[model samples]
Target: MTTSNFHGAVGTKAKPVTSQFQFGPWTLTAVKSHILESEGIARQRFEGELELPQVPEMIFADNVLRLQHVAGFGLEFNALDALKLVDAHNDPLKVAVAQAWKEARADCEHINEVVKPFDWTFTTEYKGTLIGKDGVQLKVEPTDERIDLEKLKVREKIHFYEDILLFDDELSDNGSSIMNVKIRVMPTSFFILLRQFMRVDNVVVRVLDTRLYHEAEKDFILREHSYKESKVQDIQGPPHIVTDPNQVAQLLPIKRETFEKLIFPSSSISQKEADAIR
Candidate 1:
């Protein structure tokens, strides 16, 4: 049987998290492992895309109104894990052959096919725990309690995408030699950022990029954009930024215990009665 026929051999295939990963201030704890799936049978036919989950609107609205900070948890990109893919596919022997083919203008597309196993994708569900700055640990349950808690339906979803394509030639033993790599955080990651501004102290998203050409000083560049509290003096954009990633990780609905203790704003009265009282 060809490799294309069976991608069913299932188990987590990832490298250990490197020390370089800095998740800013929030502490994350995960239960389940990240799952990797190949996009195609071979490198030539390979096409990959990140999967996005559908979250309900009520999840965002319900908690924001309560003035409580919602923490983001679950699976996010592991830049370090991608190196595993680069290392496997970009073997020196394979790179040499790919180079030879291009130099000779030869047509051997199997190179792409043989390297297909190295092109992989991962999905992380919102099932984990996050500790806020105040030391409150919210245990995120997988039951997806938005509907029952917020009276909100998840009719649509936010999306963020980063496509990493590693040709057989660009791959390397450590995945550092891989080039022409495009790293991006989709527009959908900014929802949790509101928490950073309104209540939390730190928030950030991670990105990884590999090179496509020789003479690149580094194998990969790890970068991240963090949110900071700033006051905007002009309208050119937001006080801190002009645009933002789409939001994710809505605050959990307020519980009965916390709801009863909130200090509500003063009730409104019509202006006519106020004028007479004055």
Candidate 2:
């Protein structure tokens, strides 16, 4: 489809993609495929260098494809670098340079394999029954209200590598209105290891609480705006002031002021005015 048609159709689906460099094979592949589809996406994917979980859906889709390369981190030890390091080590001033280069290369290789997946599965350990206040066992009828997650304290144990998410339901013996559900989550440790390639560790857990996660994010953004405003006040005092040329220069980083009254007052001294004052 054309760019306008594609953008209109995709909506938020065409939003930017960020990378942590540590993506599993499937995740990387999906991300790369998304990038290949559009020049804007490709540019964003490479240029953003954003961490994981920042855009949860993008990470999820990309995690399905599995990419194999780090975006900007070029090899520090190509043949040329190797030769230069070897020559430098030959000098009396840099005898350890060669060994240092080898260590650095090894470390980079280790980082490269971080996003690869391994056995990422866990089993649901708890055995229990769900019921309503009416003394009806949930095993008989799976009604949303009877065993609904809203009232139920259901916990889930997720294992990423094994590709299985285990759902656990734990409740109190009492016939209380609320079902005490406990979600015991465990994903393959290797999945975390894969994130290490991108210097990340909490990838799977990061995506677990989507709703609360966004709420917290919104709160953070608001707080950040307040903090920024406070800082601006501290640095610049009250905003309304004479539109002196110097003050206008200081406010350049902010958007240009449309109204002369809203902006700083002019302080430019014309040649005739300066001569008259002198």
Q: For candidate 2, write residues 160-263 as lDDT tens digits.
A: 22121111111111100110111111221111111000001111110011010001001110000000001223334344321222342233233111110111
Instruction: Go through the candidates in order and give each one's C-alpha lDDT.
Output: 0.21, 0.20
Supply candidate 1's per-residue lDDT for 265: 16
Q: lDDT tens string, model 1, 162-228?
A: 2322211111111112111222122211111111112111222211211111011111112222222
By TM-score, how accurate is candidate 1?
0.18
lDDT of 1 at 80: 29
Tell me each candidate's RMSD, in Å, in order: 23.1, 29.3
**Runs off by more than 4 Å, candidate 1:** 1-25, 29-46, 50-70, 73-76, 79-98, 101-278
Stretch of 10 with least lDDT, candidate 1: 57-66
Best by TM-score: 1
Q: lDDT (0-100) at residue 57 of candidate 2? A: 12
